[model samples]
Target chain A: MSTVERTPSQWRVYRSYHSPFDPCPPRTRYFNVPPNVLQPFQTSARKQFAPHEALRKGTLWPEYFSPYPPEARGGEAE
Target chain B: MKAIWIYEKKLQYPVRVSKCDPRLAKMLIEQYGGADGELSAALRYLNQRYSIPDKVIGLLTDIGTEEFAHLEMIATMVYKLTKDATPEQLRAAGLADHYVNHSHALFYHDAAGNPWTATYIQAKGDPIADLYEDIAAEEKARATYQWIIDNTDDPDIVDSLRFLREREVVHSLRFREAVEILKEYNHTKKVF
Candidate 1:
């Protein structure tokens, strides 16, 4: 006999209500604009914060979270 | 930066092998401490993090953490596969060498019983070089998983291996993206 096929446990869909504590609960922010809207101004649009700026702001961007502290250099430390 | 890890009380992929298979256990150990195993992957990414810039650091940290979880899963699979197995069974399956070393306990070693070593990975301070190495590591891991999948008949083991293999593919993609971001950062820095 072939290996028994077991169906994975079905997960219950939990609807997440926006937490009042969250000032921007996704979709609430206009950052993820549709490509059509973002494409035309993409070149001239206001540039987003640099990696360090995002880190200082505690932004969710991954680029800013270095596990190691930056080195003593004035430029972008390690 | 503050550490972002939250302990998940479960394996990302469940390993529920139905029967003890010592040979399978031995083979699975390669995924545990083999030259291209999860342990190496975790260490490689974690150690590589210090020199990486922002986004790449985050990616490495996250992927490295996930590799630890994968390491645990592999360890668990090896434990289950060898559980309660007799010396005769171990010998018959060519796992007597491992049994002699660890006595049915999970030890970090490859199928050939080579202990895990630090030399398996490199964190070369260059982000581009490290990311490329990360990508290659993931491919090697995916290949090992596929090889294990080919060798195993256990559905539970196969399913778990498949999940781990898919994760390697995803990690490769993320590392590739990190490489692109690093290149862009360097390009912009040069321009400015």
Candidate 2:
């Protein structure tokens, strides 16, 4: 019943990269809001969220402190 | 502990100046020790902080950083104001003195067009004296910002000026707090 067409090349490329990690879970979700709404709808769950959650959501910690060089990590003692 | 140095690492702030207006840029440069007020504030806070006692070191360090931010804000304003300026407007604003020498590049100079010099700042190394001087300097900056805001018709310029003015107020409060802390330290030592 489906009318959508898929090319052989598209299927091959998709199959080639298909691995356990290919369908990794999303880190965040997007919400769609109605244009007519005057005020943003507040989620009750967000209200009681912990401070760490707020920090993770709001702050750019990763950008502020980048990782050290690989050599700086130090090798095992011989 | 050592102080953390922060670099803006951006263009850092840009200002859009029309060909018709150039005086505003010339005036904003005053804060960077350009014509006198700002550069003086930056140099004053930085130099004076070094001599402050350990008890007030944190406060001094914070104020010094704020001074650096103000310097950036002023420089951004100057850049915006001077951007796309015509030769006639620049000459009329007496920016010719700067453009003639620096070629449209911004430099710290006094209101009278003298280049910024280190003699503008004093660091006596006395906490009490330094605190007093800082309080006075903040007031001077606040007044300067107020004047700039009052004189400028541009909303963008006014907005930046107002922000700078509020910062001056905040810095003044912090300096006062530092003074109180120093006084308390003296009191506790006396009691012991």
Winning candidate number (DockQ): 1
Q: Give me the chain B TM-score of candidate 1.
A: 0.93
Candidate 1, superposed: residue stretches over 4 Å from native: A1-78, B186-192
> Residue pairs in steric clash, candidate 1?
A63-B54, A63-B55
**What is the per-residue lDDT of model 1 for residues B34-153, given as tens digits with 9 covering 90 to 100?**
999999999889888888887777888889999999999998888887778898998999987777767878888888888889999997887778877888898788778867876877
Writing each residue's lDDT as its tens digit, candidate 2 over B25-116 gives 76666677642376677667766666677777777776677677667777777776676777777888878878878776777775567778
Write down the DockQ of candidate 1.
0.02
Native contacts retained by candidate 2: 0.00
Could you give the CAPRI-style class of model 1? incorrect
How much of the real interface does each model capture, measured as fnat?
0.00, 0.00
Tens digits of per-residue lDDT for model 2, A1-78? 212323321110111233567566422211111111112122233333255632322212211111111121122111
Worst 10 residues of 2 chain B by lDDT: B10-19
